[model samples]
Target: MTETDPVTAAPSGKGLDARLVVRRGSFRLDVELSAAPGDVVALLGPNGAGKTTALRALAGLTPLSEGGRLWLDGVRLDRTPPESRPVGVVFQDYLLFPHLSALDNIAFGPRCRGVPKAEARTQAAAWLERMGLAEFAGTRPRRLSGGQAQRVAVARALATRPRLLLLDEPLAALDARTRLDVRAQLRHHLADFEAVAVLVTHDPLDAMVLADRLVVVEDGRVVQEGGPSDIARGPRTDYIAQLVGLNLYRGEAEGHTVRLEAGPAITTTERLDGPVFVAFPPGAVTLHRDRPSGSSARNLWQCRVAGLETHGDQIRVDLTGELPLAADLTTVATAELGLRPGSSVWATVKAAQTHAYPA
Candidate 1:
């Protein structure tokens, strides 16, 4: 599939439109992705899903077996080698040389690009200061903390002044506490980069927080691609639904009636026709011990509780019966009902709470 630039008539500034296909024995990876200038797109997937392989292909480290098309700002890049590609790559490990200081690490790229030694050092110094690493400019990678090393990696990548920036798990090596601080800073840096930035990450929060759109990969293929809110609200696959934590259903809608594939019908406030998506977060679901005789709840289910797990102060109950659905309950209510793995329960959901939209 070809992805034409959305800003077709306008001048190509800092954007990437590329198609890659890599095959090795039995495993094959095909990716067709594009982003506008200043757009951050996240390539998200589980481990060994070829997310990293896709990034390497963009960087010219991996050869494409079928398609080798690459364009940056309307300029053909398919013939460009790794060193020749106007791209910056930040590895998962923040692969800085142990022999070099932070300043030297950032300077290395520009120097190799034929910039004067004095100018390269000056450029590197500016980047280090911008990244708040001036104090550690003289420090080696072995001496820097995980967060510091990551910032240095980004600074080094940006020093190359690339038109297309590729980041592979930029924050994966950081500790949990460091990740929060780094995430905010990284977002700010990406916005001001004036270039198309692509990030590969397995963490859902990382993708959602850093990217404008997400291209979800599964088993070496692009399965889903859309805006962050769109992906979160209507995850197409079970893996995606669990990643974003939303209940998703596929059904045909006529007016307000939605017939589920699993033999349960739901009525919603939304008015739509044809194939549609109905979604509700687990927290929106409420549980009851018994179905009310004349209840206001539009949707009711007599389900058996299959499992209960504590999620902080809330209890998440897994149920099976008419339809398998997850519901969130308070710890107090769970104990009040003496809820267990095999307890009988009733689930009530309001039509207004459920969202129904065209698929």
Candidate 2:
């Protein structure tokens, strides 16, 4: 696509714009991405979904396919070498040099880019101060805490003043408590950054919280792209719906009823026509030991309990029968219903609980 094309164009004449294509035997990844300066877009997907491949392509670590292209700040970078490209990468493990002090590690990038040792050290010191890591300047990567090392890695990336910043699971290395604090700090730093940033992650919470926009890649292609709330409320693919904790199905809709392609029809509050997607949260489903004859719910089905697992404080029961779906219930309710695998049960959901949108 041309630079001016609405689908793949960055805002105005600058920022990031590219189509990344990579072929590895039978697997091919073709994904188009665009972002304005100061925008942070997350490449989110499941394992082996090419999120890392896309990030590597952007950093020039992976060669693009014959038809692929890369651009940043209106400058073409298709043939640029990794060391020559104005890109900074923060790897999953942080990749700090164990032998070097934190400050020296941060200075390495600037030093490699032709800056004098003293000047590079000065810049690195400033970055450490900015990232609140000046106190750990003399400490080696082995001595720094996970959160401290992460901030140091980010400082090291920023010390070179790159035009494009790429983070591959930047927060994935920290523990739960550390991740919470570091994620907030990272968000603050990213807000202050003016260059384009692309983050690759499988964590929906990370992508939704840290990114200004989300580009969901699945099976080597862009399945959906939009604001966090938009994608959360209206997921287009089963993967996305599952990521956002919603059960989804594609079907033909006529008025309030949607005839699913693979299962029973669903009744929704929306009166849509043509092909559509029906979605509802697992919590929307109510289960019963036997069918309720006087139920007010318009949608009901006789289902068999396929599986049961604890989801946080509630029990999530997987059902299979006329309609395959999931239901969430409290532990007390689960025991009261005497639910178990192979047990027969009835599931019901109000029409208002289901959402239907055009496919």
Candidate 3:
């Protein structure tokens, strides 16, 4: 079945409903998305996953292939020009006119929509004040800081009073410190917005923190769509599992044992009998210098260290052997074990540490 089949039974006519299809050479992007007013949906994926293509389709900046449809507030917009659509787009680079002041840059949108010059400036002033950039109204884009420039871009977008908002990597241009501050501010503004907002981003933390719902796209299709917490706890794809820092495997479960398709079996606390997925965090694994004996842990595997890297405050050990997986250890513990690329070690995990769910 198509992605929109389940949700298209009854169109509410008050929000966004779209089936974006774009074909480029051998690549085809077909993504279905629906959101109500006041809903913030994030399109998240790795590079070349069509996240940006979906965003462009929503903004009417890119034409859709045959059979594609786009509707916002019950209005057909697939054939409408970008300027005629009631959509506001904040590009990755802000795209502010360098010669225009902050106020003029924002006022330009309303003026183009035929609002009187004075009235458009008034609206721009209000947006600038709301965005806490009132004092920088006359400042040029080159003179403003990164966060300030982002706020101005958002204010400019809001000045148009669009029914749908599109942000393409809104924080991609900011520095690390500025990103945190802008992310918080952007979340607050999104919460207050009564329109449908779609954000395109590859950063997992940004998606989790700023969006009310996440749509994980890969290979031009929606791989998963759900709440951030749900996706974090039970990832369906290896890309998502790795993004959330979990070792995931598909297997068939019988009683308490899940036989992995790749070659090993994992003992889980849950009792099920069907195809299932097993997942555990790297922190749940313990590595020993030698084979552990008389251990209460139900799972053990002799592995060879394939690589080592620093992950935050812990050392992440990549292993390959009976069951390839990752384990996290402290630098001191790693030294004590004398672990290196070819070091042999035993890894153990209690049955309770693993989680299994239906495939």
- TM-score to native of every candidate shown: 0.91, 0.95, 0.95
Residues 168-284, candidate 1: write the lDDT tens digits. Answer: 999989889999999999999998988899999989989999999999999889999999998987788777887898778878998888998776888899988898878888887
Better of 1 and 2 by lDDT: 2
lDDT of all predictions: 0.87, 0.92, 0.93
Model 3 CA deviation exceeding 4 Å by range: 1-10
Q: Name the candidate, 1 or 2, with the larger TM-score value.
A: 2
lDDT of 3 at 10: 38
What TM-score would you give candidate 3 relative to the actual structure? Answer: 0.95
Give every collision pair in model 3: none
Candidate 1 overall lDDT versus native: 0.87
Q: lDDT by residue for model 2 over 1-359, one digit each (tens)?
A: 68666434444587888999999999899999988989999999989999999999999888999778788887778788999999999999999999999999999999999999999999999999988888888999999999999999999998888889999999998999999999999999999999999999999999999999999999899999999999999999989998998989999999999999988889999999999999999999999998899888999999999999999899999999999999999999999999999999999999999989999
TM-score winner between candidates 1 and 3: 3
Candidate 2 backbone collisions, by pair? none
